[model samples]
Target: MEDWYYKVDEKFLICSICGYHYDKYAEYDEENNTPFRVEISGGYGSVHLETKKGDWIRIYLDGNLSAGELKAYKNVFENCNKEKSYLMTYEGNGFFTIHFGNPPEHFLISFKEYLENLPEDRQNDVF
Candidate 1:
């Protein structure tokens, strides 16, 4: 097997609930030239992997994350095998990103709770 590490050639999203797999970077619409992405449909936490090697994170928060959601994100960012996770929030319509030096190609989208909540239960589990 080839040691394809830190290569953006391949990307995937794995579900932590039903153990489902999805294509992360395969968001391309031929007709409209738009990419449709499906994150963790139903799961406690999800994982996004990129063969490309880079420590960069960009997450858009639309007030969709459920309770303890932010904590989950921090959890993943904190234990990123780095000295410290740098986090910054902007004032642009909830647009935020994280820059990690030598970050792992695999991104574990941590969600505190997916279910067990009534109102936010139906919300899509994605940052």
Candidate 2:
């Protein structure tokens, strides 16, 4: 049997059920001194998502994504009309859908207020 494990931000997290190490991070902008790096390895039969908490969410592989498709997806994530935080959902095939679950607008104001108290560089790191 194949072993499965998850690694988040350099720490290896063992899946209790599979007893395998899955080391994956969702790191972006290596020059930014971030603590993680997003890596995708499985192909054809499986796709894995390793969150910052070292949790592995596995999904069956169904299709491939071209460079353009990937860029479009990232664009959607980075340039969405969202009032707060949001998540992405794959709508079968190779398309993706964005879902917004932002809290109340007032809460967002307060959250932003709190974030503003942090250093300028720290604010840029919110993803």
Which predicted model would earn the best lDDT? 2
TM-score of each: 0.23, 0.20
Per-prediction count of colliding residue pairs? 8, 13
**Over the full model, what C-alpha lDDT does candidate 2 score relative to the true structure?**
0.42
Tens-digit per-residue lDDT, 67-91, candidate 1? 3765676567655634433333333
Residue range 1-127, candidate 2, lDDT tens digits: 2222344335434422112344545555577577665343322222233444455444433345456755654455454434443333443344333333332333233446856776888775542
Off by over 4 Å in 1: 1-54, 81-84, 88-127
Per-candidate Cα lDDT values, in order, are 0.39, 0.42
Error of 1 at 48 (Å): 14
Q: lDDT for model 1, on a 0 to 1 scale? A: 0.39
